[model samples]
Target chain A: MAMERHERFSLPKVWKPRNVGEAWSLKRSFGSDAEYVAGGTLLRTWWEGEVAERPAHLIDIRSLPLLAGIRIAEEGGTGIGACTTLAEIRRSCGLAAEYPALPEAVLQIGAYSIRNVGTIGGNVASGIGDALPALLVYDAELLWFDGSEERIAISEWLERPEDCRRDRGKLLMQVRLPDRANAVETPTGGGNAPFSVYRKVGRREAFTPSVATVAISAGRTEDGRLERVRIAAGGGAAVPHRLYAAESLLEGKTPDPDLLPLIHEAVEETFRPKGDVFAGEEYRKRTAANLVAAELWKLSAGRQGKE
Target chain B: MIDNRTELAPAQSRLTLRVNGAACEIAAPPSTRLLQVIREFIGLTGTKRSCEIGRCGACMVLVDGEPVNACLAMAYQVQGAEITTIEGIASGTELHPVQRAFLEEGGFQCGYCTPGMVLSVKALLDRSPDPSDEEVEEALSGNLCRCTGYGGIRRAVRRAIELGR
Candidate 1:
């Protein structure tokens, strides 16, 4: 039988941890030999693609009630558990309506089957998840259980050096999307009317790694001046970050087509994207810049018609 | 390779899975994947194994009525869930509408990708009886077919919707 053949890489020992504390202790004990697995779809990809070594132990944390379900606040906003699958988020009509780009990005991440097994927490933690850019625009924060519960902004955590976080033994408890995340397309069309967008250019229409991904969110004052403008770039191997230089240029100013060239230059200068065999560094930078530039131009042109 | 038994011995675990409306008790290593248990242990080869990674939906199965990648999921992880593979998709001996539609529409050529495709189509039809062309394309995106150029698959899906209605 094929299974009779000697296998070089032995399968890892599975550990079902009942709670976050147990999961954390297992990781701490096993050190590099262990991995905390929720859906494990992302980890499989990493191991198969040679991006990382296969761990000798997998601590299944999916059964932990502390890391389950989406809680929509009666007042506003939503708190999504770390183990919530991508499909679960997509099926959430209220979540999809509130943060349109999040579900849109989730739908485009992979096919239905992939989404069914992949968790949003794994995606965010992987640091290369396509959802990062959209989540960045929404100003999302993560609650982590590292010894005790520690809540921190996603942007702040992303800014920390990766080496420092590698052995931190922090378990992501849940992600909180504040009420302001619902600032997408209000009919009032007055001061503080917001518009948000997420664009991902992949090698194919679907089921491919991103070439360059960008997300933008801004509100216009009564006179159409940009307010609270946020721009982010990520996807592929790129570590997502806010494009503050480009954002500052568009902020407190009307999104004019004329300023797009300057904003394009700002993105090119700010974002340092990684390159793989499929795309080059320059190509990703250009693509990322162009995507945001084009989106800004569209917003500007729409106002042009109104004028 | 020299110490295979020593490495594989300690990881064994017993799992009970509800598959095809039957209860299956499997004693295997915790390292065993759900696809391996389904095909090797249960002897149900209807779920095709292509890309072991989640990239290919060739090993697609309905876990609690949701389409999931069998290859990506571990046997121990899905022990308590109800699993439905392509073999269990039909209502007994009678050919399922999805299977019949694919047969009439000639949705496959090499026949290697048929089982996965049929299951994927069944998943779509079961959820949304009348799915849009875009939704159909989206659902089948994970399952790759090297034959029929997807034109026949698209036709089969439409026919399945009609037969379902």
Candidate 2:
């Protein structure tokens, strides 16, 4: 009879590869026994008992060539490599112009050094904090390279809480952003194009995680009517999601002073926040609602003035 | 106690680094963090370690002309890479433009965060040459100075940009 040995509290063996091909080779060799580590920011937290069991083997994937750029796709959207650092994303010229909200969210993710080490893949895989809101607003898709296959989608990758806790084998490979026109284009005839605004209520200005974060883009028609609007919020919800109801209510509506209450109500229905150390449910709810109204108002005003 | 004279075998993962215009090699563990190998093995103590986690930019070093946190990077990852620490920022006795700006603008009080801050400024100037105030702030946002010397740091970055131009 063979004996199964369970070593308690053993530090996982670490493997450092020179590039992505070597990383993939290691991933195939170890199968599910290995976990790819880019920055190790999240892994250390788990090691210190802040989370669950660490994978038995750490496969370092920072040197992978495919996962290190923010470039415009031939099809017109932005293509951010999986291992591209938040610092790199924040500094990318094309991303800064096309997806302003993304850079803003990246800037707010951690202190400078964390940005230097933390990768876009890590941010999306963790499925916490600013990444969700930022990507959701941009209608970003996750590209996964399983040992034997590749898959891509916005809705298919993330599970809905119940399914996620049951199993965890999905490794996020890359994030593919949709074209800018698809992301920010309006239905009605455009006057001046809309701009994105990202707002987060955190405990402090820097180094603290967000209590609630919101990213919104609103465009207006030539006649001062709302053309299109997109809203995504995180940190207060079980999973970060788009405020579809709020978005539906906002589109085609003129933002008069009285519109604020209706906008607030629509956004409030989208999220039911729970209390934590950073902020209570009531405060988050109020702030989230207010931020939507304020940002929408500003966008509408700016569009109206330009028209 | 057991005989303490057993010569410990050196963990040998070859690291090829072009550091400060000089090529150097060191044998270390593949898992050894670049910060550890640099400070302990190579004996370059200019880069400080704080938090060890990526949250603090205290151990920042320039890897291939980009600023990266050394604590989060393995030494093996830096093979065939160009690295510049705070020690390599000057030529002989003369200070780099960034260093000169830091000195003239009083960029450090506690001095713990200076190395990372300087490296970050060097990286920004290497790319942008003349970055806006917001860009400078964004670049240095990763570094945390406990003495709240941001005003002077900002001035130093701006001065370095001017001097570089």
RMSD of each: 4.5, 7.5
Best model per TM-score: 1
**Residue B163 displacement (Å), model 1:** 1.2
Please, what is the TM-score per model? Answer: 0.92, 0.82
* C-alpha lDDT values of all predictions: 0.82, 0.72
Give one digit per residue, the lDDT tens place, for model 2 in B80-113.
8898999998988999999999989899898899
Superposed by TM-score, candidate 1 places the C-alpha of residue A146 at a distance from the truth, in angstroms, of 1.3
Q: Where does candidate 1 stray beyond 4 Å? A: A1-9, A73-76, A163-167, A181-192, B1-12
Q: What is the DockQ of each candidate?
A: 0.41, 0.20
Error of 1 at A242 (Å): 0.8
Off by over 4 Å in 2: A1-33, A44-54, A62-78, A147-159, A162-167, A180-195, A218-228, A236-238, B1-12, B158-165
